[model samples]
Target: MLMDKLREGAQGRGAKIVFWLIILSFSLAGVGSYLNRPADTSPAKVNDQPITAQEFDQAYQSERGRMQQQFGESFAELADNPEYVRQMRQAVLDRLINQLAVDQQAREAKIRIGDQQIKDTIRAMPEFQKDGQFNNELYLNLLSQARLDPNSFSESIRNQLLQQTWASSLTGTDFVLPSEVTLIDKLLQQTRDAQLYTVPVAHFQKTVSVTDAELETYYKANSNQFRSQEQVNVNFVELDAAALAANIKVEDRELRDYYEQHIDQYRTAERRQVAHILISDKDAAVAEKQAETVLTQLKGGADFAALAKEFSSDKLSARNGGELDWFERGVMDPEFEKAAFALSKPGELSAVVKSQFGLHIIKLVGVQPEHERPFDEVKADVLAKLKADKARDLFIDQQQKLSELAFENPDSLDVVSESMGLKLQQSGLMTTSTAKAPFDDAKLKQQAFAENLRDTNANSEVITVGEGKAYVLHILEHKPAMVRPLADVKADVEAAVKLQKAQVEAEKQAATLLSKLNNGEDVSALVKELDVKVESKTGISRTGATLVGTLLNELFRMPHPAADKPVRKLVAMPEGDQVILVLNKVTDTDQPSAAKSMLQTQLAQGRMIASQAALLQQARDAATIEYNPLFNSQPVSE
Candidate 1:
């Protein structure tokens, strides 16, 4: 019931924001909890906790960092859209506010997060530790540098623990009944019998024609789509991990020692290919007796494959003579696994064994014993990993120096380049379209185009692209963003206009066909009259491989058919293809096997997640949340 509400509410933007807010609370686990300093403006406040603007900016930057990686070149395009920025910032703020709510709820419930918990968490953090042990002086020094006192920092750690505990209490407490599991399983695995009437976008595209004026009008109206990409050229210095790895030299003695120490890592586990004839029945006694009878037949020199194919209840493996391909331990039921592994030789059979699935007569078919590859064969991999490890250690030391040098001498990358022996390099004028690595990296690009770097003409702080790789750059040249002239994109504009018209015509034809089909028109007659092609099928699963993605979704979304009438839906695919669906019947699973167990687990988890999300919403409602003038709750028009 809770899951149904969540799925239904998921269509709303508010519910999605709330769902993601729950996720973000856990993701930003150790962020600064609360700041008490009096400020001109507060971004938001949850109950008694005042959220500082700096915290909001930090969260926003983290969000941007994630988006920068995922969207790549397109992320920069998002900046031009003000609404995206507003929503992103609001989301971050909401997450922070939700976190405070979680903390409050945990305290109200008498959850005690002691100082020892905070101390343990802080000690475990790599930033505050050296050589895997907590260094009090280092921790204090780093906190002092950040201008965060030890006391306040420890408080933040306490909050993180409370939030963690609170999140833990929310899950692992919900469950599903057997009936609920069966119903959900049936719904999920249900198949449909349907017929498809497709009107190809290509057919309409060939029939449609657009005027030059229409093309020009579209180009002018959607100028943003044809805007020139923003870009920057920079003079930079980089400490690359691959370069460092190449320069390092290792002794043969060290290589031999390392190989010997970690030799077990290269060893492969033993695997067995076995066949079993399963005797699955609700009555355990019946199943065990049947399995014993099969075992007796095998002992009497009956062919194993023939008996398995005839008697095995597991239909999937039975067809292949009950052959289950090579498997290692930990994948099968404990009793079944132990029984299967106990067979010492090929063609050896196990006595009837009881498992979760019922009773099984097991046979050992083939074996591949555990073995390690020769050192010569694995030398290349060993060397690569060793190089990576050495480079990572070197990078940590060098990265700190790089950041210090760039900041202390901000005028140019020359200082860091000369000090670290890295060559000072210059990038060609690269637009968002033409940007290539290492400059093409999100952090590097963001730094290259940052207002402060451009305004000050100073070297950027060390920007890390990946593990053991960092760069410091200063912008040398900039290109202001502009839309391309209509003449330059004339061909693209013409294609767009034609496709738009063609899509409209295709949708019209598809909708008309759908109306006719639902109103009792025969599909065979409409195929000739509407110039569309029809394909029919039965028992199409949700994961139907032959069905187009959009049409498949629409097929299941439609209500079940009544009597002779079928459920009808028209789908307009993004790429201009149109499909009219006629869903004739819904066939649900009659007797579920392991699927019921799987759904029970999944439904239990879903119920917990839904409960957690609902609680977060309730917390937000109960708390006093105030946003400054910078934030507006009203929707932003695109």
Candidate 2:
């Protein structure tokens, strides 16, 4: 149970603080190398500690899996790009080197995490708890499922704790100076009001016209924008478990056997339809007294729902007369669940039950008996499960065979497709960014366009397209990237050139308007002359989201208006428009005590993070690191 708790806690923590600190530290320190060993055996070394090729490959694969999980099919396409792959490899190596450096430093500092500390950490994790206390059985079961033994998992936790201690000691106190806190508070509380006059590029379009020579020159210079991406057509074969399930046959005996073996899955636990008048408070004495009073009112023949509605602190259920609907054991707090379940008769009220939420007066309103679903009623579901289980087993066998066959006959996919009784599928011409169904995978595209395979016209090795799906393909046709003729994209080029000319005219007009405003001419009067409307917004802050584009940003950047003088500036927008912003007033309000406290906490946390990063960089500079040339020359998988 303790082991299970450790596994559940580890997975929930997800590599922990040390892992992230290492990654962030190395990123800022730059790559370091010590001495190069044989390329085939180790890819990197830190202070003579070799990072084995197997370790590197495993970390690389784990990172790839995480990316695939996060980005889905899109990551496969990203993985195909050489630059993205190179970045991923470098990131993996950086993390390894940084971790080694930190581990060495911790050893030298004699910062050891004791076994008791590891036990305490594991015990504190909420994942392995039942009824607000750690459960030994749950902890062990979780570890068994995660395939981790207690001793090794505990050791890993200990090391992480040691690293965390060393890091925290280096970071020191997260104290912020009084002056810095005051400045941050002032920034957060400051507000500005502005008058905005927008000059749309469309307004200047009529005054701007593109010449034929200008259009032609623009098209020639930006021809790459109109170029078509290189595309390919491929012949491929795909295998998935769902498709294979249709060919699987499950007999009656097999279905019956599966149903009997998994009978517990179909059993329903006893449930109680309960309602409670809860008096929640941090003070147990106050909550218990309130609960006693509510219970006394119920005993005096007062309507439960009416009294509950008036006194219950549980606002959500109070509206419906404190109806919590039906729930089984483990769904509610153990103390509450026990008290509610113990009442056998409907309308029976229990003594005030004390739980984490304070005190509760539980009433049993309805009951549901535990029962197992009849075999005949669930036969269809049982049969489906049996077939699905059989299909999964079959898919494993067939997928392995397919891989072996495809590798043996890499010249073409025809033989493997024929032997596997699968049809050879064809894809329409697709570019590198194609995310269409069936042909949407980037990894598949990368494999199809591999130089070795494309040059030889040979088949690709089997690639996992998605969960439980694999495919192999051979390129049938390839088209090199090319620029479209001037005639083909002349209309697009003309439109783009016209838009650019309009933006230039708009900027020139805005500059002239700013000059007039700077010379003491009122912005509203100038905007009226230009036939543009002036919009006024009050109480805009540094991070206000109402004003679009650079309007809000420009307002904050302008100096505060003195006495009667308003600050003015011309700002460009992303949509080719210009805004003449007039900072009318700046208000500095005093921050509330609660907000000031929160800000102080945030500033302290930021300072600590920065300090930790600096310490990591210092450690890396003191360590000797080296990388093998093989890291650059070899594929990540190799």
The CA lDDT of each predicted structure is 0.80, 0.80
Q: What would the per-residue lDDT of candidate 2 be over residues 300-348, giving only the tens digit for each residue?
A: 8878889779988887789999888566665566798899999999999
State the local distance difference test value for candidate 1: 0.80
**TM-score of each model, in listed order:** 0.51, 0.64
Whose TM-score is greatest here?
Answer: 2
TM-score of 2: 0.64
**Model 2 CA RMSD to the hidden true structure, in angstroms:** 16.7
Compute the lDDT of residue 286 as modeled in candidate 1.
81
Residue pairs with backbone atoms closer than 3 Å in model 1 (clashes) = none
Cα deviation at 49, candidate 2, in Å, is 4.6
Model 1's C-alpha root-mean-square deviation from the true structure amounts to: 21.0
Cα RMSD for candidates in order: 21.0, 16.7
